[model samples]
Target: MEEREITIVKGKRSTPFSRGILAQTLSQAGAKPELAHRIASEVRAELLAEQRYTVEEEEVLARVRDKLIKKDALVVERLDKWRILRESTEPIVVLIGGATGVGTSTLAADVARRLNIQSVIGTDSIREVLRHAISPDLVPALHKSSYAIKPEDIRIPVKEENTTLYGFRIQASQVAVGVEAIVDRGLKEGTNLVIEGVHLVPEIILDRYRDHPNVCSLVVYLSDEAAHRSRFYIRALGTAMRRPAEEYIAHFGEIRQIHDYIVESARRMGVHTVENFSIENSSDAAVEIVANRVSGIAEKAARRPSSLLLDASARGG
Candidate 1:
């Protein structure tokens, strides 16, 4: 008893025993094997009472089947089933970019909600997070670089929920890094990602992963002249007026130029273009269009490579 770790079996006091010793005694007792198994199960349950284990039984089974197929442990039919299951489970990645005040953020939120994705990342949030890595003095300049309003003139609303504006400016490099982090995380977790911003596009964010099988990046340009002008005017009169008129005017042109550049670049890159302005009812129509296009893209991506390979093999044959 002194040399070995011992525990007193307190249940029913059938016999005084240690933990391991009790298990042996229970097995050897004149109890039916099934009864003894039940007793052992009960004892184990009691011992683990304070700990909690969440077992998703279906997910576990699927994973086990997948592993078997990967390892060639299953029959041909079962292996085919596992392969189909694995292909169907791969996730989708969507990047939505448009000019400012084009409802990109709002549309992204709606799409994410429709998809039941609770984790949503905006470009502004990513910018704020990367602010710490930027130089303090250079941050103000960086902020001004992308905007018509001077850093000093812009007074962000002082509210608990509006703290996303207080951080340092995010440079292009920083924005690219943040986008990659979010996109990579989403793909790895088998979850969908909606990245909305003016800067999200190829040669910046999506180009890095152009070859990835699970990634789908679409450039949505809101191209209604009247709506664009109206929104621009409203924004200009609201928070943008804090800056000098000349500075504000200068930024307006710059933003417009950037928007045109993005549209042209998207076309050149062959990214799917959705004309949000043409839709009769913008919000609802935008959501419907996004859902349809995204689903279609996902389906195409899942099948395109296989089809291409099959065609190539047929040609070779």
Candidate 2:
């Protein structure tokens, strides 16, 4: 039997059928790799068997969705949500918050990969920028730790019952101003972003974005303090800078206090949360959470009329 290939038709233009695009759509819909590949291959065979030399782009998607629906109903739902994300007019913003050792950076990097969003910013980076902008002598709060902070140095109020906690909140507040500015730019430019770091506390950062349809926010924690400490050891080896295991352990009390504050605030804000025992599961959970929040805007985006050939160059033909 001679083999055949299908070209996807878009308006007046056409391109070869891309198995990669079908497989990616399936994977984004939460299908396991083996399953997504199997479905994509199956869909390709079915369409080509129809003997159509050229196929409409919508028809291509329909065939892929039909195969997915037969395999698992939930995947079809996920596909629709994934489609919404792809077709959205507004850029998606994912905010991940946690204390120093809780894997916020790891989770953000992974989620950014899954979502295909190019911009990922750490709040620490934001802080560093602010530091260069202002003098440490003037804004001492910007120069120091949330715990053991000298009130006179940073202008933190000593009268607060928990000055350590108050100081941490103040530090987060300073960094969040920069966070919001970056987020606003992404939103205005329609570029998806993933932002993670300690300073992204719920009250300071998550609360403002929670009500936005284009935003997905999560706070992660290490339920086991001992396990949390171990992450620094593994992290130090991966990066150029040595992890400050001793400094962090010495101030574990302050860090833990900030962790508790974030968890409590996330609870109140009704944002999604992850416990960082397993990075794989935590990353998966974040994708699902982001999908749920972005679903509302998907259909509206999908209904939009377009003349561009969005799938003409999807991976391989």
Candidate 3:
């Protein structure tokens, strides 16, 4: 008996070829057409359970047909007799940032979920980590440099478990090291980082990494005047999880001013901007924008020199 050789090609945002292969294999084993289809569906569902598809479900069936066409070409030409194969890997990085209440965190998470990539990292988490490793007094100073905290005699409760405790001690010189660590660990692991915060501007952090090939930095400013003000007021009134109303109310103006400055800085940096006023549709729109941008960056990187990887490797060195 001659063995039939098979080749598999996976498409971006498409169904698994293993399903069709299962159906064909079962049919070759003398199974009925209906039984083969049923068995293939079960097998495909099991295989697909381990992976997530960013593409729509309907597109998967079409993708399967495309894959089958390519397979047919290979079989017709008997190309298996001579092997010529190449594979390229390209990763994408999306740096999403904005003011405190601009829904940056939620947007990052939503984008990550849609892309099926875990690369989202909030800037607040970075700040919190830095604070944890530095002196509490230095936090106010660092915050001042980023213009995120206003000069005031008011004292803030420094949580020991928070990242900003020691972050105040982190110098601008040290920011590169922190960013490198995050990117190497996050992006290399196939997670798209959505680092958000007032300080995530190019002048502050990304300038050090602008030329890196693996990184496609995007600064998203979520603009919503009415909603922003309403959210700020809600925080000022003190939510169930936070401090008293008077405490937040006293600093409302200062916080709002800081956010405005951040938005202005982002605008000056020529960051890709998105006006996210409609909160209801913002998540889906954000996901689409981010995914499309990332896909573009990845496609470009595929054609670029491998030396680009060296740019990422040189970070913090």
Report the number of the highest-lDDT candidate: 2
In order, what is each prediction's RMSD in angstroms? 19.3, 3.8, 13.3
lDDT of 2 by residue, 217-273 (tens): 999998798898888767776776554667777888888888888899899988778
How displaced is residue 250 in candidate 1, in Å?
6.2
lDDT of 1: 0.49
In angstroms, what RMSD does candidate 2 have relative to the true structure? 3.8
lDDT of 3 by residue, 94-211 (tens): 5665655666666667545433344566655665677678665654554333322332311545543322312322333244456668877765765445555545655566655566
Sorted on TM-score, best first, the list reads 2, 3, 1
Query: What is each predicted model's overall lDDT from 0 to 1?
Result: 0.49, 0.78, 0.46
In model 2, the Cα lDDT at residue 216 comes to 88
Pairwise TM-score winner, candidates 1 and 2: 2
Q: Rank the candidates by lDDT, best first.
A: 2, 1, 3
lDDT of 1 at 189: 80
Which structure among the candidates has the greatest TM-score? Answer: 2
Candidate 3 Cα outliers beyond 4 Å, as residue runs: 1-60, 63-88, 137-139, 142-177, 184-191, 211-213, 220-224, 233-240, 244-249, 300-317
After TM-score superposition, the amount by which residue 201's alpha carbon in candidate 1 deviates from its true location, in angstroms, is 2.8
Query: How do the predictions measure up, each by TM-score?
Result: 0.50, 0.83, 0.53
